[model samples]
Target: MVNLQVCSFNMVGILFLLSLILPTISGDCTCDANTEEKHNSAALHYKLGAIASILLSSVAGVCLPMLGKKIPALRPENDFFFVIKALAAGVILATGFIHILPDSFADLTSPCLNQNPWGNFPFSGFFAMVSAIATLMVDAYATGYYTRLHFNKQANAGELEGGANENDGHVHVHTHAVHGHAHGAVIPTESMTLPELTRHRIIAQVLELGIVFHSVIIGIDMGASQSVSTIRPLVAALSFHQFFEGIGLGGCISQAKFETKSAAIMATFFSLTTPLGAVIGIGISSTYNENSPTSLIVEGTFNGLASGILIYMALVDLLAADFMNPRLQNNFKLQLWVNAALLLGAGCMSLLAKWA
Candidate 1:
């Protein structure tokens, strides 16, 4: 987790530095057209409306899954919960591939960015691949480190208890590993262990980072635009699509099973980030240039990173982990439902992206 955060922050710094050094491309006379600051009251009204609607939708969608304890049907332990996870995973996958990745490509390869570097290479895809590898490294290292730490503590405890036998720690660790892997060739997701819960927690945090990154970018785009026609469709589209993202993130938080305060914090963070970004963009709309070299590189790079993290989590952590669980393997009917739910979610999000 620490490694992941560090890498992201570093990427941000690198993008910032590149933006400073890279020369802007003068694509056409119209490239300077947007530099003029014009305040439109109609656009402002729509933005205010958009902010309120998006906030309400985001809060409601995310809070729904967090209410699982009170609403037993939605609880993670329920067999139906896998269907929700599958749906969420599909939404995230589509968001990465259909929405954010394309946006990154457009931004990095925009006419406003120089062709020498930005257009010369597929920087968006390259950064996305790098981010995915980094996420994998973080996932593997964190799980491995925690597993070792837990077993070492257990070994020490046994030694302190007057040489209480625990198979010298190494053999016990091997046995535990074997037992974990032997569940009908399924991952032990249904069987919650300390390590499993910790893994879920990590997944929640990493997912939040990716979703929030993309959310803020789009929110800013909407907020900074002064065009009423564009903002109108975006207002409805963003509010509608963001609800799916909220549900996906909320489902992960539910699986993590954080305490009340921590869970609420995560939920609120997701619910507010886009709105907060909108507010920031609204404040700076006078000088904000979506087509500027600085904005393009920064937004494009972050979008690339976000796409990678989200894609990795959706494929490996959520879908693969849950689909391979023994519960789904043994229940053919449930498996069909889960897969269908995934398709439904992906299709819904993809359809909505046409507007957003």
Candidate 2:
């Protein structure tokens, strides 16, 4: 509880500082008045098309892993499942490094912002670093808290059993020894423990938060733009972007083993965030200015934070955890295949950055 409170306080402080600096550092930056005044009926049509295409792609991508239970080849126990997860992790990693990070840098370092503060400082890198550290703190504390809770429950159960079996204490002890051995033998091949499952659930939720932050920003920008040519290509690129990202998130959600209702809620939430942002953008398009100092600061800060969370998650939670697993470590052939898949996923996402 103390740690959590400290983390919360730190976040509040950081946000407060950003709010103070953003307005004062407006610099020489001004929105492109010429672009904002332009209107294209064709762009409106493309925006609508983008909404439908992105929504469907997101739904399909996320639902694919949830359906894995019905297909033996896609089940979590299958070797191929690891390969798919690796690909997803790679995509996420590339998105953080290649796509979001650069955007944040561009936003915070724009010439329109004041040179004394915004130009003098690498706020983008600073925010990204701070956010990454914050994510690590959350991940560590949450895992430790859950693990401690699980063990405490087990200890309480043992106490109850001890009180009930005074007469058969020795026999119970002997039986427990054998039981423990049996449980230990199956640990390597069996599904995740309760604590491990809880950790995965936390990871999936946090990962979604990071992804949604960037998705909404991108969607809004796409919606607000008046160029049919720009919206047309972005519609396809972002569709593919959301699809692959959904697959990555879906794999984690599937492994978390959420109930049907919970899974549906999460999946629906992920699928709708982008489209919802676009809709909101459409409503505000006439007045919204992406290049405004306020817009740049808000979007840039959030993007930096999201990039950090994603980079940490992809590198530490996803890649390191899987690569270091005994099963992967012991099998050279599987490791090679997984590496290839990782590269392929990263390459594909990087290519999408060209347009998206």
Candidate 3:
């Protein structure tokens, strides 16, 4: 009798330890450990499918803007182009605010975390504040570096000019006059010179970094999720998500005016990231725990950082740069329409969070 009691106690102890390792109820329900394992296997396949779908959609979305060079309607100088870019920016802004940040909050505040440090304070706000500051620093540094480089280049050019075009030469005279005219334009115009081109390049590079950060994280999350029912909806939602994100990035790339090869490479990189991330996640899913302490910290930090960068880019680089231009400000009706378009874009993206 005593031996039987000891055996029963040992079984209970083992069960308790198992519960601590993975909190699960022993049942034939859908969410049981065994069911989850099976679902995770199916989810892996579905995630791959989602990755392919999103990659294709991203390619299509980005290619549309690049190929629009053939259409005068999609020209950079057109009013419609401005509206489209603004809408894209709005989507990115909403993505940072609505999607990623909220997910970070949910993960960081999950019941799985220990109550001592995790439950003691507002970690999300603190992390977000740090990220915002870090983004501002990066923006300031990049802009300053480029500005200094431009000044040095101009100084060197002036030195070279002293030996030849001591007076206003043919190219110099034309350029000087055109620079004046460009300044007089209603837009917040800059001398359309090498410096301007350099600035655009820097902006595109940084924007790409910001976007890829979030894209990979989302892809990994989807891949790691062990639920086929959940993964199926994400497959479609993420396709649309990547498509719109591609449009936003594509518009920025268009304005940057990179060389053909460089532009194509950038677009391809964006298109491939989410899918590549899904593949990576699949390979590491056994070791990658979304709810693990390390994962929660890493994901939350990245989410905060990505959110800050996207928000800053959308507000300062995209919206402010255009909205503050004399043309946009002076045209009341166009401004109204653009504002409506912005709101609509943000609304649509935020709504996607319901499923994605």
TM-score of each: 0.83, 0.83, 0.79
Question: Per-residue lDDT of 1-356 in model 1, one digit per residue for the tens?
Answer: 22334634653454344333322432242454555444589999999999999999899878877888789988988877888878878888998999999999998998887889998999999988998999898888877776676567556655655454655655655555456444311122455776786688778878887887787788778887887777888877778777877887898888876656667877887888788777766766766667777778888998999999999989999999989999899999999999999999889888977677
Model 3, range 265-325, lDDT digits (tens) per residue?
Answer: 7788788777766765665666555666656666776677778778877887778878997
CA shift of 178, model 1, Å: 26
* Candidate 3 wrong stretches, greater than 4 Å: 1-41, 165-196
- Give every collision pair in model 1: none
Per residue, candidate 2 scores C-alpha lDDT tens digits across 1-356 of: 12223433443354344334433432344644435344568888999999999999999988887889797777776788889889988889999999999999998887656677888988888888998898888777877786676556446556767767666665554465456434321111157775577567778777877887787778777877787767888888888878878888888888877657666867887898788777766766766766677778888988898899899889987889889989999999999999999999999989988887
Using lDDT, rank the candidates from best to worst: 1, 2, 3
Better of 1 and 3 by TM-score: 1
Question: How many residue pairs clash per model?
Answer: 0, 3, 0
lDDT of each: 0.77, 0.76, 0.69
- After the best TM-score superposition of candidate 2, give how far the Cα of residue 36 lies from its true spot, in angstroms: 9.6
